[model samples]
Target: MKRPGIMIKDVFKRLTMKPVTSKYPAEKSPAEPGYRGKMEFYVDKCISCGMCAKDCPSFACVMEEIDGKKRPVFYLDKCMFCAQCEESCPKDAIKMTTEYELAHLAGNPQIVK
Candidate 1:
């Protein structure tokens, strides 16, 4: 192991570098490729296969029977933002969007068809 002076030098070097923090809300940050932020569902394209709910690792996805068709209900509070549901959808109905601003006052469930 190196001396403690080496660690101090590393810290000083980082301090001299430009800050990497983003000004969120005031300025939007670009998401990296394949970054999973939010989930969106295309209702008409969905076949009600229930694959998305079954494949969700966080148990955030649920298939509900609404009206005459089965719809997907996503609990964002319980989601890990893994985008597993998007990959499991056979009909290409589910998608992971770049929308990461999911803060809500009432915290309601997202009903996607």
Candidate 2:
């Protein structure tokens, strides 16, 4: 029903236009506000209540004995980044940072001491 030349015209128009996607690896994108990417643990504010470990869905948070005191160890390999630990911390010991580059070759967990 449409003219055959219309399809050709549309294709040519698209070909002359600039690309919309950015060069990712060569160029870093700015993170937006309130973006939850990574987790940061504050040992000074922690109370050893173990609430962060208890509410963690992925079991990424675990209380370990550190220098005769119980401390939280975070395993980023298994973490879902759901911010459950941040929400459950009554002492504001846990916080989320805008750091998403977590690629690693080592088979060890990222223990936050």
Candidate 3:
């Protein structure tokens, strides 16, 4: 139980304070450097080494046979985006981009093939 005078003083202090939240949808903020958001896979750069799939902590990356060669398939829904796959790639095929708006409807798989 707080005193009425103390409560009133606290209320006045809070009312004068500036808002701590950002205008998200109305004003987009750029992602900082080294902020891992989405992944971009380059087929031409990939050497079919399967190291990216093997190093993924969330098991989001799967090695699939495509055009007679093994390629890494990214399941964005299952991915934690820790950038382990990007670090493990020797050919620099997998790179992380800062585009974070990845919302999609349920049951639709966000697969990067």
Candidate 4:
């Protein structure tokens, strides 16, 4: 246990330094190349192969019959954003976007069609 005076130098140094954190929500920072964020599903490009649902480790991608065709219903709440669905899509229907602001009120699952 050192004296209280010992920490004074460190305190002063830190106070003089600029804040490392950015002002988020006001000043948005660009995501790096290949940075996976949100999942975007292209309905037209999808072949209803169910590969994305099969590859998803979190079970976020669930296939349902829509308009007599099997389509993926994404539950963003359960998604880990691993991008496995995007990789498994043979038709290139699923893509990962740079939009990371996915927060919502409780009971809102943030489901994607």
Residue-level error in angstroms, candidate 4, position 81 = 0.8
lDDT of 3 by residue, 1-113 (tens): 85567688778988999987879989887899878988999999999999998999899999999999899999999999999999999999988999888899999988888
Q: Candidate 3, after superposition: displacement of residue 20 in Å?
A: 2.6
Q: Give the candidate order by descending lDDT.
A: 3, 4, 2, 1
Query: Which sections of candidate 1 miss by over 4 Å?
Result: 1-18, 107-113
Candidate 2 collision pairs: none
Tens digits of per-residue lDDT, candidate 4, 1-113, equal 75668888889999999998999869998888778888888899988989989999999999999999899999999999999998888899998998778899998779889
**How much lDDT does candidate 3 score?**
0.91
Tell me the tens digit of each residue's lDDT in model 2 across 5-104: 7688779988999987889879997677788888888888989999988999999889998998898899888899999999988999999999888787
**Against the hidden reference, what TM-scores do the models get?**
0.74, 0.82, 0.80, 0.80
Where model 4 places Cα greater than 4 Å from the true spot, the runs are 1-17
User: How many clashes would you count in candidate 4?
Assistant: 0
**What pairs collide in candidate 1?**
none
Would you list the C-alpha lDDT of every candidate in the order shown?
A: 0.82, 0.87, 0.91, 0.90
**RMSD (CA, Å), each prediction:** 3.2, 2.3, 3.1, 3.3
Whose lDDT is greatest here?
A: 3
User: Which of the two, 1 or 2, has more TM-score?
Assistant: 2
Is 1 or 2 the stronger prediction by lDDT? 2
TM-score of candidate 4 to 2 decimals:
0.80
**lDDT value for model 2:** 0.87
Q: What is the Cα-based lDDT of residue 16 in candidate 1? A: 98
